[model samples]
Target: MSLAAQDAAKIPEEIEWTWEVRPAHADAKLPNVLLLGDSITRNYFPEVTQDLTGVANVYLMASSTCVGDPRIEHQIAEFATMEGVRFQVVHFNNGMHGWGYSEAQYKAAFPAFMRTVRALTLESSTLIWASTTPVRIDKEVGPTNARVDERNKIALALITSAKISLDDQHALMMEHRDLYKDDIHFNDAGSKIQGDQAAAQIRAALSMNRLPKAQAR
Candidate 1:
């Protein structure tokens, strides 16, 4: 089985090896886009890929690896070597993995993460930074509400100066709390909405001017 397929088969245990295949530029007929995040991106796979159909070629790869995992550094290294390719977009989030981290740790790691992302893609490509989605915190999987909020704050501050655009995922989830299945993840519908929202943010930032239809009332 393909490495991505193997990763898809089991629940993510460690973030150590998310991508075993090195995606080549020739593999993409459209502009290459990568989705880097936790389970939300995993669950929202279809929607995120579907939404970007004509705009770009979207690649989804995420591990449940939280903010502090040494795995992120590896992922960044994999990304850096792909430079000069036709990559045009990258939508990523790390807060769900970050729930366990202290506020100070998250703050310190935020800029380094952004720098890694910046180094990988050219300035011409747009990087979409999705804020950590709101965690219920009332439940048990991980990450208290306080920590989630603090991480989001740190994420906002770090990306602001780095030319990265924010998705405000935290606000979107809070505005629609019914979407989550637990403290740190969302249901299928929630994932789809999240994907659409991220796509919208990208469109807006790039002046792509192509917004998908609004959710039904």
Candidate 2:
């Protein structure tokens, strides 16, 4: 098996949990965020939450499933049922799921994915769509990083016309190529960098600047 597949199989089937920055935080009401993405975002959530302290209430869920699966819909539905968790930012990534799908499949499901996202929250919640990060195709990663790039463009187009803000994670990954441990995944340091970038994007979209040190927890 490829390294990606091997690594994926080792991940527990149940939702892998992480240390959440508690809601008792001083800035708890700033905004609530839900991170939805594949392994890359999954691996990077800790770093994301760290930089986001005092800026938002962040919850993360990682799935290795592709964008075409029914599980994507199911996952969103489960999150929607979280009582009293008011989400102000729903940051998500999914082109990795679209990577190997046929052209027809991607075209059909892309809109459905957006609809699902829109249906998940209040009409005013800011939606940030991350472009698929670059991969080194020559390595044992997935098929082609180029495919990821293509799908990112599709995602950008969809979000732009829909008027949702887009976080260019592809650009972030390229800016720090050394962060990646392999073609498609980041080591801990890289993951932290990615998380920091994501925090910045969400901050910008919501106009929530980083708070003073004395005020942050």
Candidate 3:
């Protein structure tokens, strides 16, 4: 078995799924932007794409794999290899799923996530870390804001140290508790808010080191 398969056998989950979207850009002229995250990222991807429009060609790689899972890096690597496109900006998040893993496990495995993400920094890719959103639902068995806070804190230290831009979705959603579609996911409005903010951040990063239009692929 492969390393990812071996990792999979170590800790099985209730379910596992991955979703990726790479819109065709025949003779594409716009720079590419990649959004990497879970369902929440998937929710906001459309809005980001719409917001970016002619500015950039947006790509999405959202999965249920959490930071603690060894397979997550493999998933990211495989997705990156499959696309074979230079990402001008990569906005990413995790920490919503993989409830089976302990917070300690999450932190322990987070460095590997950073390593995988940093590999995409080729060609001056601007990296932005989207803080995982809050959990509004009070459930007998589900995510909690306390755990979310801990994970964000752990991630923030690394991101800040690395100088990656931050899109604080958790802090944003904290102000709009009513916008949740469910315990974890957001409503259309919340998603729009997140997407618009994400797009604004991406734009700032892109403008910081504006590649000549001639460099677009």
Best by TM-score: 3
- What TM-score should be assigned to candidate 3? 0.90
Residue pairs clashing in model 1 are: 66-97, 67-97
Per residue, candidate 3 scores C-alpha lDDT tens digits across 1-217 of 4444433443546878899998866238877889999999999999999899888889999999888777898899999899888788999999888877777778777878988988865656789999999987655666888888898999999889888889998989999999999889999999999999999999878876585656632
Please, what is the whole-model Cα lDDT of each candidate in the order they appear? 0.65, 0.68, 0.85
Which candidate order results from sorting by TM-score in descending order? 3, 2, 1
TM of each candidate vs. truth: 0.76, 0.77, 0.90
Q: Write one digit per residue (lDDT tens) for candidate 2, span 39-158.
A: 888887777787788777777766655555555676666666753465678888886643345444554567777888777656457788888888755434344776776777777787
Candidate 1 Cα errors over 4 Å, as ranges: 1-29, 79-86, 98-100, 139-141, 206-217
Taking the candidates one at a time, how many backbone clashes does each contain?
Answer: 2, 2, 1
The count of residue-pair clashes in candidate 1 stands at 2
> Candidate 2, which segments miss by more than 4 Å at Cα?
1-28, 82-84, 98-100, 139-141, 208-217
TM-score of 1: 0.76
Worst 10 residues of 3 by lDDT: 1-10
Candidate 1 per-residue lDDT over residues 1-217, each given as its tens digit: 5433332232334434454222333355456677777667777656766776676666666766555544576666665564445347778888766444456655656666776666656546778888777766554655667767777787787788776778788888788788778666788888888878887766554444233325211
